[model samples]
Target: MHGHGYGQPVKQPPHTAWLVFLRVLFVALGILTIGFLTWAMMLRLAAVTRRSLDWGLFVAVLAADILSITLVAIEPGDEIHTTGGYVGILLLLCTLVGTIAYYLAADIRHFLLQQQAYEAQRTAPAYGYPAPAAPYGATTVPTIPTVPTAPGAPGMPSASGPHTPPPMPHARVPQPPQPPLTTPPPQRPAPARIDQVRAELDELSDYLRKQDGPEGGR
Candidate 1:
């Protein structure tokens, strides 16, 4: 990070959001890694810093990513000879390996730098004068007041090891009584049956016999 100033550079605060953003960028980079590498090889090859291993690793990662992209784009069998295809595939594999190597190297470098900074802070001693001891062995120890403990106080346990918990009261919850089950009466037919018709005919025949007997008496 750079600031618009002629004075001392200010240390930027670390943002977790930036790390999340970088992760998203890295995913996007994966898709265009090889393309970026090839572009760098063509135009920005000289831009790669030769001063430090970290810079070299950075360049290598870029190159590998670009090469991987290029290799992926090349379709071996389509319009190209078998030999060319095989060569392209081999180059692609090598580029992919380089991509992985560079990525790991960059991560390791960053982690080491962070760890070094942490260690530096840890090892750095504090600069200040120490407090003088109580006037050459003339000790002055502060007295702590004694507090009386109750029989069953929170901090102090009882004389009988520990206090037992009081027994829980028994509660009988009333449940609703179940209703008795009764079978339903069968449904009768709407129309008369053959047995009902036979009973009616027998009653009619008895009535006709009674009428005949009354007529004979007359």
Candidate 2:
């Protein structure tokens, strides 16, 4: 049968030397921000603090780098050298650098805080009293006392017999009465008159004439 134990093979690291080389290649290809980000990530992994500001700064830096790279890649020629393009590229680079710097500063701050906390813990008084030394002697096992039961007398139910619960009363619920069915009375058709039809036609003609007058005026 299969079982779990600490007998499994050693797992490899998530990032290898080849990955590191590729990251270095990316850095050499004018993506210094990415390299800085990689270093920051390593620091975060090593350190205890996981601050939200640090994560936000990393995302901002990555976005700025991606934007700058996209702009440069799309307009490779003299367009990047133009005033507006140059300014945009410069601003993006500045944003990338600024975010990286902010993240590093936060990391430093967290590191200092952690160090200070560690020092405080090391210097703090030991309030825990040493547990009283376990008695150094032979121990006696505890013994439980036996309880004596009284003898059952005359015709009453014996205590040794299993108990049976009484049957519960069943209740009957009343249902609502159904409505009675009935047939509706038949409807009669009204008789048509030529005078009524002539009046309706006259009204429709007047409405049409009024609508046409507004359109004709327009």
Candidate 3:
């Protein structure tokens, strides 16, 4: 993002040797008559943006650059007199242009996206998650698919509202039959002594006869 001049200037120490070393290394990679480094950077940019770049084109460009370099080396003379020499120069020029073009375009795209992100972050609600760690738009946010609500019961197209299950009806179960109860029979009373009863009867008869005799004599 910073490479495109579309990013805000950052405050830091005057300079760092590590940064200078990297810049020199980057220059050496391209100036040594090859765009391998550019292809590497292209891949890096793609990864940072989480977007795919022209991978096949990058490889083709690098291959062309190498072939052109080889041709130029074959004719190291100051003037090029052969057809291959001319094609080599043309291809070399094209590769250089392509390398720079891709780098700038990628850088610019990243920077623009970064600027938009910063603006979004500024306007974002306070309760939202924090932005990326890269303060200079070094990272991109990935999009996630929103989860849909669970589907309800299927209904007819002409249904007025959501389909609901009917309430369960109350059921009454039959009870098992039980055995009948049994009772004991009633008992009879005991009889008195027959001889004693007979003796009493005879005594009463004798007394009655004596009273009758006394009445006749009177």
Candidate 4:
């Protein structure tokens, strides 16, 4: 049957000057990121930071743009240019995937936090210490009191019904007794090495005096 195929060209979105400007800005950002990454790889710049990550995104987009430009340049005069075109498409697809992944991760984190908040709210006690009781003006529900059983009442178990033995008082764990303090054995005085030094000094002084007297007398 001669019919228009289902694979028809989709209508392109209308492009405004602002949209064009934004595209240019994005391309610029991409270029900047790529430049920074190159600088970092060359050791001309420091390690990555938030700014680096931002720039990397910009670079990725710029790479896509370069690929696109290359494809267009190669496909002059409607001639098929498969290589550059495919490369450009691949770069763009990579960028899109990265962006989507980032957003999905952020959304998942938000969802988890929200779920945690919901769980916290659901589990809060009706009346408790940690959470303050409902405000003064809030409607409060009255609790019913349990009735005490009378002794010897029909069908009522005796007070002696399986007495829960009081939990044995926590035994005072005796810490190991500290070692008894004994007077440290008196240390022997370090041998008098200085005595030999004193004797040598005395001998030298006597020798000096004898030499000085004999020379003076002469």
- Choose the strongest candidate by TM-score: 3
| Candidate 1 C-alpha lDDT tens digits along 180-213 | 9989889776466867888899999999999999
TM-score, candidate number 3:
0.38
Residue 97's lDDT in candidate 1? 53
Q: Tell me how far the alpha carbon of residue 218 in candidate 3 is from the true structure, in angstroms, after superposition.
A: 99
Query: What is the per-residue lDDT of model 3 for residues 1-218, given as tens digits with 9 covering 90 to 100?
Result: 33333334322322346534644554466656454355554554455455545566666766887788788778857889888888888887767667766755665566566666656656753233444456685676799975444455344232344556799888878889887786866754434556667788999999999999999999
Question: What lDDT score belongs to each candidate, Candidate 1 first?
Answer: 0.53, 0.55, 0.62, 0.52
Over the stretch 38-107, how does candidate 4's per-residue lDDT look in tens digits?
A: 2222121112122455456546545655565566467646764577656655555555555444433443
Clashing pairs in 1: 33-65, 33-66, 34-65, 34-66, 34-69, 37-66
Off by over 4 Å in 3: 1-44, 76-79, 126-218
Give the poorly placed runs of model 1, Cα more than 4 Å off: 1-13, 32-51, 57-80, 115-218
What are the per-residue Cα lDDT tens digits for candidate 2 across 1-218? 86453333222333345545643453343345433333344234234345565556556555665666566667757556755566557756576455445544554565456656555545653234333455889686789974444436554554676447789888878889888888888865445676788889999999999999999999
